[model samples]
Target: MAKAVWKGTLTFGLVSLPVALYPATESHAVRFHQLQRGTTDRVRQRRVNERTGEEVPFEDVVKGYELAEGEYVVVEPAELEELSPGRSRTIEIGGFADLAEIDPVLFDKTYYLGPADPATAKVYQLLVEALAHSRRAGIAVFAMRGKEYLTAVDSTDGLLELRTMHWADELRDPQQEVPDLPARRRDFNRTELATAEQLIEMLSVAWNPDDYHDTREERVRALVEAKAEGREVALSTGAEPEATELTDLVDVLRRSLAEARAARGTGPKGGRSGTAGGSGTAGTAGRPRTVGAAGTVRAAGRPGTAGRSETVGAAGTAGTAGTAGTAGAKGGPKRERARRAPEPPEAVEDLGSLTKAELYRRAAALGVPHRSTMTRDQLQYALKAAARPRRKLGKAS
Candidate 1:
């Protein structure tokens, strides 16, 4: 069991319940130590007194606010703690609001909330049920580690989750920050718009997280292992392609649509009569493929479909099929099993066609897990699952 990061009283209305908060997520990034260049020695840092030129112990250091250049206002830790009497120990809910009304961008870190005392479990469960039923999040504020935080408490999968949020002022106006944004929508030929929309439809598919992985990490691991085993590593340099001109817009759309259709084994007529049960995608072949990466090929198509194969690229490290690329954990390539059936082309015209970022916003609103790392397909899958009603067990009819 993970230790709770915080223990406090959660008060809403006249009811008060002891609750504990635990971090809901963790980082999996590969960490590296700072090392001197061309040497194996590790680099380290220390806090020192500037004027005295001596290292300072943590216990002896006090926070000082610089009023002017050299003028300082020193405050003791005990004094700061005394400023907020019960705030550090209590989470007081101000009110409830529809979850949909809150912008997903404001949500920051997420934590799991549970009863701190075993006897208060019922109250905690009741709160979860109420929030789930009402589809509202409890807005609250609390202090921790000498800092106050704004949070939203909601329920997911019968569990209560608290998410820290950013203040409204923290958000920046895009008009001021972003450059070269189109002032107004440019009028394009209807035929061109239709072609582009059709192209998007041809490339649409269901989200599948299992189909993707961090290819860059895999490459880095492979490089390190290869050098350790005395294997030769080859590097490639490719020129960047020229940008597409505005006059070639329609032509590019038509070509891309045709290529996507052919890859899916569909004809130019846009029918779903391709190989691999019409589920196999071109280039990716259900399993994601990178343009320049591992030198391996795997059998393509979902189970119960015709056997087919596609060659993975062997050039440089680049060009992932989608959000992430699929590769084996070991040195050799691996075949992937297809888990989802192909959706009708009409799905492209639905919510499935939305960008991954847009889907993520929706997923955040629904308290979906792993939303930050989810691929576009995974986000769509999570959204569907969240919206699904749970099955109730009863006597067999």
Candidate 2:
């Protein structure tokens, strides 16, 4: 169980409920200490006077407001604390508005609100139910830790979730910050748009937060472990490819669609039929092949030709034709049973070949669980599992 960071009475109109706030999120980032290069000595930071070049004691350090260049107005800690917002036990709800009206960019840290006492549980549940039904968030102001905060409280799964918000002036305008950004609108062909939509549909899957993993943190941990084991680490210095202008939009869309279909196992196998390399026929004698859940096929040699003689499991494997299915005792044709097997666990590319940044992007897209604590191998495994097609359940008769 987690301890409550704040305890206060939440008030709205005539109703009031005692509530406790608990942090909803925590950081899992790896921490490092500063050290001198090629040495075991730790580098310590010290606050010193620039003029005297003498270290300042913690008790002597005071908050200083810079009035002008090289001039500061020093204020004692006790004086500053006295001037700050007074400690308040009440979170006064000033107004309520539609939750959707609030921009997500303005939201900051979130906290879970729970009943401070068993006697106040009923009022807390009442407020939560009201907010959930009304689809509105209560905007409030509260003083905590010598500072005042603007916050919004909304209902989430039968509980109140409070989020601290930034003032309007605090947010920076991207238009002002970014210079020479293209403002001209670009036109797209209808056919190309349709093809892109098809590609998106083929690649679309249900959102699952568990599928993502943070590979960078994992890499950092792995580096630390390797260094501890006295292992040498190799660094890559590959140049990034220059971006090329798209000459033919339709051709690019067509190629993308083809690749997407191939990945989904819906595209035609091999090249044009009777012209050279076609997947041949989908018969038992052709080649031993198995289809994955996502329609990916695995077989021996080329798609249209046979090669080695190896036993292929229902889980899809590359092998010879005779070994694919069981032959009947009376010289009967081999029965090729189409069984629902798990998708191949191999990644599209080796995890080691990708950079930590690239792995982190993939992990974010997949919504892997506990990604911040995962290692490179763990991230790779998680990504592979996330990329695998989900097994279809047979309809119950």
Best by TM-score: 1
Tell me the tens digit of each residue's lDDT in model 1 across 1-397.
7899999999999999999999998765557789999999999898989999899999998889999999999998877877775889999999997655576778899999989999988999999888766767899989888888899998777788899999889987766777864554446566566666555555443334444455456667888889989999986543334466788665554544433544455433322222432222223222322211111122222211122334323221122222111211111111111213223323434667788766765565455544664445555655665243222222233
What lDDT would each prediction earn against the true structure?
A: 0.60, 0.57
Per-residue lDDT over 1-397 for candidate 2, one digit per residue giving the tens place of the 0 to 100 score: 7899989889999888888999998778889999999998999999999999999999989888999998999888777556643335778898997544566667888899999899877788889878766666899988777667899998777889898999889987765766864453436545555555554554454333443345467778988999999999875643333343366454444443443344343434341111112222122222343332323333332221221222223322122222212211112111112222222334456767876555655665554543443446555655665342222223223
Task: Give the number of the best model, judged by lDDT.
Answer: 1
User: How well does each candidate superpose onto the true structure, as a TM-score?
Assistant: 0.68, 0.62
Flag regions of model 1 displaced more than 4 Å: 199-211, 235-242, 262-266, 269-397
User: Candidate 1, residue 113: CA error in Å?
Assistant: 1.3
